[model samples]
Each structure stands twice: as structure tokens, then as C-alpha cells.
Target chain A: MTLDFWGLGLQAVNVLILVWLLTRVFWRPVAAAIVARQTAAQALLSDAEGTQAKADAALAEVTKAREEIAAERAAMLASAAQEAEVAVQAKMAEARAKAEALVEAAKVAQGHAAEAARKEQTRQAATLAVEIAGKLLARLDPNAVQGAFLAQLVAAVEGLPEQDRAALTRGGTLVSAAALDDAGQARIAEALGKMPGLTFVVDPALIAGFVLRTQHVVLHDSWQSDLDHILKDLRHAA
Target chain B: MNSPLDAVALFQIGPVPITQAILTTWGIMAVLLLGAFALTRRLTLTPGRRQAALELIVTTMDTQIRETTGAEPAPYRGFIGTLFLFILVANWSSLIPGLDPPTAQLETDAALAVLVFLSVIWFGVQGGGVAGYLRSFASPNVVMIPLNMLESVTRVFSMFVRLFGNVMSGVFVIGIVASLAGLLVPIPLMALDLLTGLVQAYIFAVLAMVFISATVEDGTPKSQKET
Candidate 1:
């Protein structure tokens, strides 16, 4: 068969018309719809990614908050412990001060008690010597001895040295003796009368010895007084 | 020239002969059209036997369109399916006794080529603006514009010649061979002709897909990159 160019051209025109009709009727809407669906899908994918990012950020924040709360709790506990330690220290200091004050007060009270005991012992010794001397003098004749001793003590006082006699005359003396007989007492009184400044008084509590009290001097001749001096020295030494 | 077939003398307009090949082809086309019309008359969602067969063909065409165009096949499904079915029928018609394939004619082959060409232009214009569609001819580089335009024209010409030459050669060879050899010896040739018919139909469909894809969007070949 021969190739017919003219017929082919006519057929080509017919084909062109058919294609135009088909595109207008069918293809346009399908293409548009497909593009729309793809756009929607992409938008949805992006939205999901955004949501996931937000969730991740929120989770991180929550974790941070949890850690912060734990740190705060630890700090609070440490502060509480420090406060407790301070309170305990304060109590301990107060207790120590009170104990130290009580100890000082006890020492002062002990010193006061020791001084009172020493004064009491001295007063008891004086009373005991006076009673013993009285008992010894009662065995002798008290009236006879008193008269003789007075005359002797008067003579002795008259014979004393001028300075000593002068001091003796300034203040009267109290004399206590128990060993002197009546004659001896009288002789001592005569001697005291001869001395210009001498004077005498007698007491039987001296227990066989004499004691003289003067303005400037006290001569201790009582046996109980001597014994008390020796006993005090021994107690101190011991 | 001597009469080519026994039926050549039947109709004449002046000096030109109306051969049996043309008559037989027209008759076969009419019958096929009538059969398709009958099958498609009452379209149903749940198909009967004829509709089921037609649906299978449509589905296959839909898949081809999707693979080539990279879009939903539903939109171009009907038109591409119809075009394929028409070409398949035309090509196979040659296998019938005393019937020539309509596509073996320059007019028929050129018609299909022009259909592909015009579809390319129409879809390109629709997909992008007229400015964008014309810009495809200047692709790769601006200096390539003239060459690109020549290629576009040549591609259409190739479509025309390729289908024309292949179909015409088949018909020519079969006629010459059958004319020389009697019926018994020509059976193998006839079988080869049948295979050619199916091959030509497939080739035409594939070429149509290639042209259609070229016209869509900026007409750049699809890239492997994810959308």
C-alpha cells in the first residue's frame, strides 16, 4: 500500500481533537486532587514532629524540676541539722557555766565552816581550864589562902622595878594562881606593897600556876593555858 | 499494475482500487466496536462476565499509567485503556483470513502518533503554564534550545515512522510470503504475524506512556530523589 501523507495529516487533526477532549474531561481534577492529598500528608507529618518536640521539651522540664526539688530538700535537711547542732552547743555551754558557779560557791562555804570550827575550839578550851582550876582550889582552904596571898601580892607589886612598876601602876593586874600556900600569898602581897607601881588580884582557876594581865604584857603561868598552846602547835604541825 | 487480490476489481473510483484488505479491516473494526458497545452498555459496580473481562483490561492499563506517569492511575485510566484496546484489536485483525491490520496503514499509525503528540502538548500546558511548557524546549542549557526543539519535532516524527514502518513491514512481508506460498506453508508465517501483532500493540502502548510522561510537568525525567 502507498503512504498517504494527506490522509495521515487529516487523521492527525482528528487525533489532536480527541486528546484535547480527553484532557479537559478527565485529567485536570485527578492531578489537582493528587497534589492536594500530598500536601495534606506533608502538613500532617510536620505537625507530628512539632508535637513530638513539645513533648520532649516538657519531659526535660519535668526532670529538671524533679532534680531541683530533691536539691532543695537536701539543703533544707542540712540547714535543720546545723540549727540542731547550734542549739546543742548552747545548752552545753549553759550547763558548764552553772556547774562552775556551783563549784566556786562550795569552796567559799567550806572556808567559812573551817573558820567557825577554829573559834569554837578556842572558846571550849578556855571554859575547860577555868573549871579544872576551880576544882583544885576548893581542896585547899580558900579563905586563909586568899588573905595571905593578897598581902604577899601587895608587897611584890611594891618591889617591882620603876619602869615595870610604872606600867603596872597604869593598869591594874588580874592574877590567877592555885599552887601558893597562905604564907606565900601574904609574902607576895607585902612585896607587891613595897613596889611603887605593882598591884595584884588572885583567882583559883589558874590550877597550881599564876597568870598576870597588864597593860603591856600578859604572863601566862596557868598549867591549862600551857597545855592548850602545846596542843595547838602539835595540831598545826600534824 | 496487476490486481493485488481477487477482491480488487470489486470497487473502483476512477483509476484507484478499493482493495479487499481495506474492506475487511473496516468490517472487523465495526464488529469489534459493536461487541465493546454491547458489553459496556449497562455498567455495574459488581461486574458480569463481559464487564469483568473489560475491568481486568482497565485495571492493567491503570497500573501501566501509574507506573509511567507517577501519579494516580484512576485519572488517565479510561482514555489510556481505550487507546490500548483499540490498537490491540486493530493489530490482531491482521491475523484473520483475508483481513489486513488497520494500523498497517500510514493513516491509522499516523493517527495514533498524532494522538500521543497532542496529548503530550495538552497535558504539558495543563500541568504547567504555557510559558513553562514552552520552556521545556530550552532545557539542559539555553544554548540547547534549537537542538531541544529539533529533538521534540524529531521525536514526534519518530513516533509516526516507527509505528508506520513496523506495521507496514509486517503486512508487506506476510502478503509477499503468502502470495508466493500456498495456505499450508504460510501457517508458520501467520503465527509469526500474530506474534508481531501483539508486539506492535505493546510497543505502541509503551511509546505512548513515554510521550505522556515527557509532557507532564517541566518534562524533566523523574528523579530518584524522595518527594
Candidate 2:
């Protein structure tokens, strides 16, 4: 093999030139492109992260608002229920009060009507008793009624105290519904004593009996008494 | 007859005589430069088929550099890639009829070796500074400094001789065999020659990587650095 100095020198120059050219042409641009693409990818990832955070925050707010609205609705429903309950209670109470008042008014009206009926019944009973007594008295003989009343009057005069009978003999008149004959006058005089003047008063209002009037004492013995007794009994029964 | 051992002169420029090997190197350089320029002129974040293929090639080279050097691939990428491509193209040029591989010439192989030798020194000094790089020769002991220096020169010399011998022998054998054996018989040998050429190119480039990486590897030899 032969060594050529010129060939070696030329070859060296060519290699160096090729190295410089390739470095300029190929390496720098490819590296720059790769770095730029990586940077853009990183930026896109960062933007996506930010958007996700915003969306999450908005969703949280919406959830909270929905919860609040639900709570408000519940509160309103509770309030409405309470109000309705109160209104129902008030209405029931009012209805009860009105019913009680109506019952009281009806009771008062019934009492008044019962009182009026009792009064009317009492009046009718009194009038019927008086009419029945008058009819019984009209059927009786006048002499027998007069006799019975005169005997009762004589017995009552005899039963009087000595001092009372003695005081009645002074200036007293003997009153009667009928004119008494000598025997009746004499009998009454014997039982009572003659004093001052003898007076014979005929008062038909006494029916068929006698009445005594004295300064200190008076006495009743008449058919009208029997009628009063009958009226008293009938009133007690009614 | 034996083929001529010397590179033939094609032209001259001033004191420099441009040879056939130099002219062929220029044609190869032009093709590579134009292709690179066109591919890189309009680049995109999204790559086309041609661009994707090109990136695949570059990525593979970068991965190989990292595995070979155990250092970042950025600083050494351009020079090492250029060396591999130039030698690979030169070694395979013999496939063209009447065209000889430039690596078969001693001057061309010598020039490639010189470039690798210089790059090793440059990268070493850049990595460890001048004093630190000089101190690397005395590794294991100060007594080994002279031997280490001689080893450095001889190893670069071995690179040039190895490339020149393999490619030249392959071409010579094919030529001699074709003259004696008929045309079709030498085809198999030519095929074998093609395989040999690719293997030799790979070996030369890998050896260059080892020599350069040795200088930059924590400013120590590969054996000591591993230890």
C-alpha cells in the first residue's frame, strides 16, 4: 500500500465539512419541534384541569341551592299544616259554641212554655173546682144547711173562755144571714148573756148561717166556710 | 496482475490534488445533504411516512449512542452519526459497477481514523478539562502513562488499518475470483462481500465509539470506570 498525503488531507477536509453541514441541517430543527410539541401538550393538560375545577365548583353550588330549596319547601309545608290545624280547631270550637248556644236557647224557650202551661192548668183547675162546689151547694135544702151551720156556731160559742164570753155580751149585735125565730134567739142568748140591746141583723151574704160582732171579738159560722174548705182542698191536690 | 494500491488523482485545486475517492465522497455527501435538507425544510409536530421513518432512524441512533457511551447522546450525535453514515455509504459503494469503495483506500480510512482520534480528545478535554484528561493516561498507576499514550496512538492506527485491510481484501478477492471463475460464480462471493462490507462498517463505527467514549467516561478507561 502507498500513502498519499494529498488524499488524506482532502478526505479530512471533506469529513469536517460534512459534520458541520449535517449538524446545521438536521439536529437543531428536529429538537426544537419536539420541545414545542411537548410544551403545547402540557398547556392543553393544564387548561383541562382548570375547566374541571370550575365545573366541580358549579356543581357543588347547584347541589347546595337544591338542598336549600328543599328545606324551604319542607318548612312551608309544615307551616301550612300547622295553620290548617289551628283553623280546624277554631272552626270546631266555634261550631261547638253555636250548638251549645242553640241548646241553651231551646231549653229557655221550653222552660217558658212549660211555665205558661202550668199557669194555664192551675187557672183551669181553680175555675173547675169553684164551679163544682157551687153546683153541690145549689142541690142542698136551704133549711138543712142553715141548721147544720147554727148547731156548729152554738157549740163554738159554748167552748169559749168565760172572760171572752163575758166581754162579748156588752153592746155587741148578733148578725145572721136569715131572721132567727124566738127559740134560736133565746138559745144563743142563754149561751152568751144578754147585754145592752138585742140586735137582729139579716145579712143574706152569709148564706144560711150566723155571724157575731162584738167590740172585742167576732165569730164566723156560715155555709160560705164549707165552700172555702172545699176550694182549699182542691188547690192542695192540684 | 495485482490492482493499483494508490488512489487515482481526478483533479487539482491549488496545492491539493483531488482524487477519485474524494470525488466519490463528495457525491455521497451531496446526496445525504440534499436528502436531509428536503426532509427537514418543512417539519411538523405530526410526522408523515418519510419523516416518521427518518425520526425512527435518528431515535435508534440516539438509543445506540446512549447504550454505547453511558452519556447524553446530544453532544456526540452529529459527528458519530456522520462517521457511521459516511463509512457505511463508502463501504457499500462497491455494489455499483466500476465504482470502488473509498474505505478500501488507505488515505480515506486514515482520514476517518484521524477524525475519530481528534473527536476523542476534544470530547475528553470538554468533559474533564485539560489537566483531568491528561491525568486519565496514568490510570491504575503513574508508571502506565507512557504505555497508555502509545496504546491511544496504536488503537487509532489499528482503526485505519483494520478498515483499509478488510475492504481492500474483499474488493481484491472479488476481482481476482471474477478473472479466474466465470461471471456467475463470483456472484455468491459478491454477496458475501456485501455482508462483509456491512459488518466491517459496523465494526469500524463501534470501535470509534469505544475509543471516544473511553475518553469521556468519567475521565477514565472503560475497565477502571466500570470498577
Candidate 3:
């Protein structure tokens, strides 16, 4: 309306006082609350971001640990396999050595058995020949001049060639008083044939002693050839 | 001629007929105050039937202040609300049979303009500092310094003239029309007068809010310079 200068001034003063009172009473707390609300919201957002970052870091750490454990497990498994292979190889080598030793022991035992069997066969042959010669000697004469004549003949034959003398020396002569049968003489002749240049002769005074002679040498004794042959075979077998 | 409205005779004070349009204006103010006081005596936050009408007016003003100032309505609530209520009452006062709108006079409009001018300077000084208040005129550029200073002076004058001219023209036109036509024919013209009165009042309050907001800014040209 139409207020004069004084009235208008008073109205202006009234408006100013009213505005001041309203601002002080009503607006201050509302403004403060708004600012506080904004600040709290910002703080809460930052805290959420920080917590999310921590969770991500923890997840990454957990993943890293799992990977490391997996790698360690793989390494352990590989090491175990390698150790198992080494153990298997060692056992194989030990078994190979044991098998080789067993084969060598079997060879040695086989060689010993073969040598003993040869010696036993030689001994049995000598004993049978000696017994045969002893029986023949008992049937021969006890005493006679002829026997002394025979001894003289044998001494003459002992002076023979060295090649023929070695052959007669390998098997000493066995003398028998009994006459040889056809088969027995044939066996004696065949044995003498294996020793060439040696002769087998029997004297009655010698009693079953057979003399093995060459042109210049004679070997005389009962069962002497059998014993000498047996001794020679035994030395060869050993 | 004959003077159409016989303005000197029809408008008067008690024994002295005011040649300056003062008596008609005071009568309007008195009536408006009486009516407003009658409408809202026992004020309530929730509002009864009669109080609800008053609350609607206050709320409309509150919304306008909040939109224009871009600040909480609570901060400048009282000033904006009072300005709106006072202007509304003054404008509506002209609807009475024998009353003239007081705001139609140069003296009354200039007084309201001066109030706005003073409030702008006062709030500016209070918002920042003396230095900050002076710096508001120097903004945009150093070249704008003189222009800004002149603008502040011109703004008060513009406020004064706009409200004065608009209200006075409406009254003058209506008075002329009433003289030409008879009483019965002037009814529509009187309705138009009511609309114009409300518009002028709203313009004055809105312009006052704009001035107050401009002055209250921090006056730091760093932001304007960046733009």
C-alpha cells in the first residue's frame, strides 16, 4: 500500500527482525542436519569401498595359497615316483647279481662231480684186474728151476729202447701161473695192442704175474700193471 | 475539455483531497490488513478450513522462493513469505469498491524498491565480507567493473519504475474506462484490474528475490572465469 518514508522504514525494520528470528530459530538446525547427513553418507560409501578392497585382497591371497599348495603337491608326487623308480632299479640289480652267483656255483659243482666219477671208474677197474691176477698166481707152481730161468729172461728184456721202455713202464707186468682162456688172452692182447711195442707174458714161478715187455725191456710183477695204470688214471683225474 | 474521470474530486483524504493519489491508497491498505487479519487469526500447522486457504498462499510463496533462490526455503523463508503475503494483500485490496491500489503510486513503489535494494546490500555484506561485497560488482571481467557498478544502481531504479508504471497504468486505464462507459459496463474492466494487480505484486516480489540472491552469492569469480 502507500506507506510514507517513515512507515515503510518501520515495515522494513519489522521484516528484517522477523527474518533474523526465523533464520536463527528454524534454519540453523535444519542446515546442520543436512550437512551431517551428507558427510555420513560419504563416509559410509568410502568404508564400503575399503571393505570391498580388503575382501578382494583376501580372495587373491586365498587363491595364491591354493595354487602354491597344488604346485607343492605335484612336486611331492613327482618325487615319490622318482624314488619308487630308483628303488625298483636297485632291487633289479641285486636280483641280477644273485642269479649270476647261483649259475657260477652250479657250474663248479658240476665240474667236481664229473672229476669224482672218472676217478671212481678208474679205481674199480684196477681192483678187478688185481683180483684176477691173484687167482691166477695161486694156481701157478710154487718152486721150480724154470722160474729162475724166467726171472733171468725178464731181466734181459728190461734193457730195451727208451720209447718202448716208457710204454712198458706205464703198465708193470702181471704174471699168472694158470694158462689164459681164449677170451682172457684176447682181452690181454687187446689191452697190450693199445700200448704198442709192449708184450704181455705169464711165468709159472711168478704165480699170476704177467710180464709186459718190449725188445729191450720187461716190466714184471703180479697186479703191477693194474696198480700202476690205476695210479696214473687217478693223477690225471685230479 | 472535460476531465473524464473527475480524478481530483472522486479521490480524497478526510478534509484535504489528496491530489497525489495518497488517500485512496491508504484506504486500500487499511482494508487489506483488516481482511487478512480476519481470515487467519488462530494459525495452525495442520490448518482448519479457513487456515488452509492461508497455508496455500504461504506454501506457494515458499515453493517460489526455493525455486528462484536455489537454496533451502528455510533460509530465506520468512523474508520471501512476508514479501509475498504483503504484496498479495495490497493487490487484493484494490478489489474493494472505494479503494485504490496503494502500489499504483510512485512513492509507495519506490519505498518497496528501496527496501529490496537495502536488503540486497545488507545480506551481501553479511554473506561474505566488505571486500567480498565490493568484489561482486567487479566480476565476469575487470571491464565489467564499471558496468556492474552502474547495473546495481540501475537495478534499484528499474525495480522502482516497473512496479510503479504497471500498477499506475492499470489504475489509470480502469479509471478512464469507468468514466467513458457507465458503472454497469465497467465490471469486466474491474475484473481485469484484479488480474493485473496480482501480476504486479508477483513481479515485485520475484524481482526482490532475484536481487537478494544475486547479492548473497560468494562473489568469487574463479568459477565464472573457469566457465
Candidate 4:
């Protein structure tokens, strides 16, 4: 067996040179590439994480703003609803008051209309009674109706005051519902205590009995006159 | 056929006689250098298929170194990776007609073993210091220092013998078979030699890495004392 130290030395030197060359060409460049890629990836990941954080922050802000808007909207809606309710109540009260006033006015007008109608009816009844009495007296003996009226007139003259009787005794005109016969005039004048200048005037509206009118007094003793006095008393009472 | 132990000078350069093994070694170096240069020409961050393939090779080497040493692969990567590549290419060069693998020669194998021995010491010194590298021999106790020192030389010598013996035997066996059986009979043996060559290259590289890392780790605690 043989070993060559010279050859061994040469081979070792060659391998060492090869290792040096390959290191420069292969190992360093490739390792640098890997390291560069890793660094770039880390940078990209950091940027992405930063962007995600920003996005999350923006989203949170938006959510908070939306919540605030919703709360404000709810508050405004509640306020508006309260105001609307108050307005509705006020309008309702006003409408109720107006309705009551209209009812009161309608009741007053109805009462007035009822009073007018009752007055008209009463007046018509009084006129109807007077017309019926005139017709009834025309059917009766005229002298008997005159005698009954003369008795009423004599009672009314007796109840007169002495001063009023003295004033009524002065000259006056006699108004009769019809042309007065001498006996009717004498009866009315005797009941009136001798009213002077008494003239008998015929008035169809007075119907039959005589009415003596003096300067200060007048005496009525006729069915028509009696009915007229009754009608006037009913008007006053109504 | 020449003896497997013989390295006949094919030529001479001044006082230095150049053997076939040396010539083949140079050719292998040229091919590796050119190929490396060409492959790495257009390296980009975004790699194409060629770049991906180159990266895969480098990444695999780094991974193997990292796994084996448990230290960073950068300092050891160049020497270990080149050693493996050169050995593998040299061993497989036997596939060429009438060409013997340089690793089959005693000188080449011895040179590789010597380089491994030197690298162990270098990395040990680099990881610690000169005194720390020397202190690696005293691991466990000072009593075993002499044995550890002897074991270090013998271990490197054993590596040289193992590589030379395996490659030389395979080549010699194939040569004997081809000479006796008149060619074609050595084909199967040649195929076996390919597997053996690949295994030897892997073993040499792994053993070199282990020896270097072991020394570095062993010397580390003593490094502070030396510093």
C-alpha cells in the first residue's frame, strides 16, 4: 500500500478552493434571497394588520355614530309624539266646548220659537173666542145681551173713584158696538152717572152693547167691549 | 488493470506530477462552478421552475445541516455542501466509459478526510477559541484527554479508510468482473457501486458535520475560560 502526501495536499487545496467559490456563487446569494423574501413577507403582513386595525376602528366609529343617530331619532320621535298628543287633547277640548255652545244656542232658539208659537196660538184662540161670542150674542136677544152688559157697566161705574166719576160726568162721546137705541143710551148714561154731551157712535167691531167715552173716563157695557177687555188682560198676562 | 492502491501520474507540471484523479477533480470543479453560475444568473424573489429547483436544493442542504448540528447552518453550509456535491459527482463519474471516480483514489479520499479533520478544528476554534478547541479533547474529564486526542486522529483516519475502502473495493470488484467475464458482467456491480457511491457521499458529509458540531459544542463551555 502507498500514500502520496503531495497528491493529498493538492487535492485538499482544490476542494478548499471549490468550497470558497461555491460559497460565493451559491450559498450566500440563495440565503440572501430567502432572507429578503421573509423580510418582505413580514412587512406585508404588518401592513395588512395595520389596515385591518384601521378598518376596525372606522367600523366602530360608524357603529357608534349610527347608535347615536338612532337614539336621537327616538328622542325626537318621542318629543313629537308628546306634542301631537297635547295638540290632539287641546283640539278635542275646544271641539267639545264649541259643541256645548252650539247645543246651548239651539236650546235658547228653540225656547224662543216655542214661546212665539204659544203666543200666536193664544192670540188666535182669543180672537176665535171673541168672534164666537159675537156670533152667540147675535143669536141671543140683543136687548137681553145689552141688559146683562148694562148691569156689568153699572157695577164697574159704582166701583169708580168720586174724582174719576166727576171727570167722567163731563161731556163725552158714547161708543157702541151698534147704533144705540134710546133705551140702551139711557141705561149706559144712567150707569155712568150722567156723562154730558154723550154721543152714540156705531162700531161694528163693538158688536152690540154701548160704550160711553168721556174726556177723562169711558164706560163700556157691550159684549164686544167685554170681549176686547178680556183679550187685553190675556195679552198682559201672557 | 492498475492496482486500486496506485495513483499513476498521467502528466507532470514542473516538479508536481498530475494524476488522472487530479485532472478529473479539476473537470468536476469546472462543471460545478459553471453550472452554479448559470443556474443562479436570474434569481428572483418570485421564482420560476429553475429558480424553485435551485432553491429547493439549497433549502434541503440547510435543513440537513440545521437538523444534524442543531446550530445555525450558515457557517458550515459551504464546506459541507461542497464536500457532498464533489464526492457524489466524483463517485458517479465512474459511469463514464473508461473513467474512474476520483474518490476511488487513496489521495482524494485522504484529502477529503484531512479537510474534514481540519474543518472540525476550524469550526471548534471559531465557535470557541484555540485553547477551547484544544480543550475539546478533555471532555468528561482530564483523565480521558489522551484517549480523546488519539480518538480524534484515529476517527479521521478511519473516515479516510472507510471511504477509500468502499469505493476502491466496488471499483476493483467491477474491474475484476469485467476483465474475467468479458464486459457486460460488471453492469450490475456498476449499478451497485452507484448506490454505494451515493451512500458513501452522504455518510462522509454527515460524519463531517457531526464531528465539527460535536467539537464546537464540546469546546463551548471551556471557551469562556480561554476568552
> What is the clash count for each candidate, in the order shown?
27, 0, 16, 1
- Residue pairs with colliding backbones in model 4 are A171-A196
Model 3 chain B is weakest, by summed lDDT over 10 consecutive residues, at: B4-13
- Pick the winner on DockQ between candidates 1 and 3: 1
lDDT of 4 by residue, B1-227 (tens): 76657899988877777999999999999999999999888788888998888888889999999999897898998999999999999999999988888999999999999999989998999987997788788897899899998988999999989998999888889888888998788999999999999999999999999999989988888545466
What is each candidate's DockQ, to 2 decimals?
0.12, 0.44, 0.06, 0.57
TM-score per model over all chains: 0.46, 0.59, 0.44, 0.74
lDDT by residue (tens digit), candidate 4, A99-199: 99999999999999999999988888888877887788788776666677666666787778878767667767767655657776676568667744666
Q: Write the per-residue lDDT of candidate 1 for residues B42-98, one digit (tens) a residue.
A: 655445786556556555666777777687675455456545655667777777776
Q: Which regions of candidate 4 are displaced past 4 Å?
A: A40-147, A156-238, B14-17, B42-46, B165-199, B222-227
> Which model is ahead, 2 or 4, in terms of TM-score?
4
Cα lDDT tens digits for candidate 2, A1-238 = 5788888978998989999898888766665666566688888888988988998999999999999999999999999999999999999999999999999999999999997788678757776776666666656776777677777777888899998788767767777767877777777777776633557798866666777878878777765555566667656665
RMSD of 1: 12.5
Docking class of 3: incorrect
Angstrom error of the Cα, residue B172, model 3: value is 1.0
After superposition, candidate 1 runs with Cα above 4 Å error = A1-3, A13-238, B2-29, B219-227
DockQ of 4: 0.57
In model 2, state the lDDT of residue B13: 88
Pitting candidate 2 against candidate 3, the one with the higher lDDT is 2
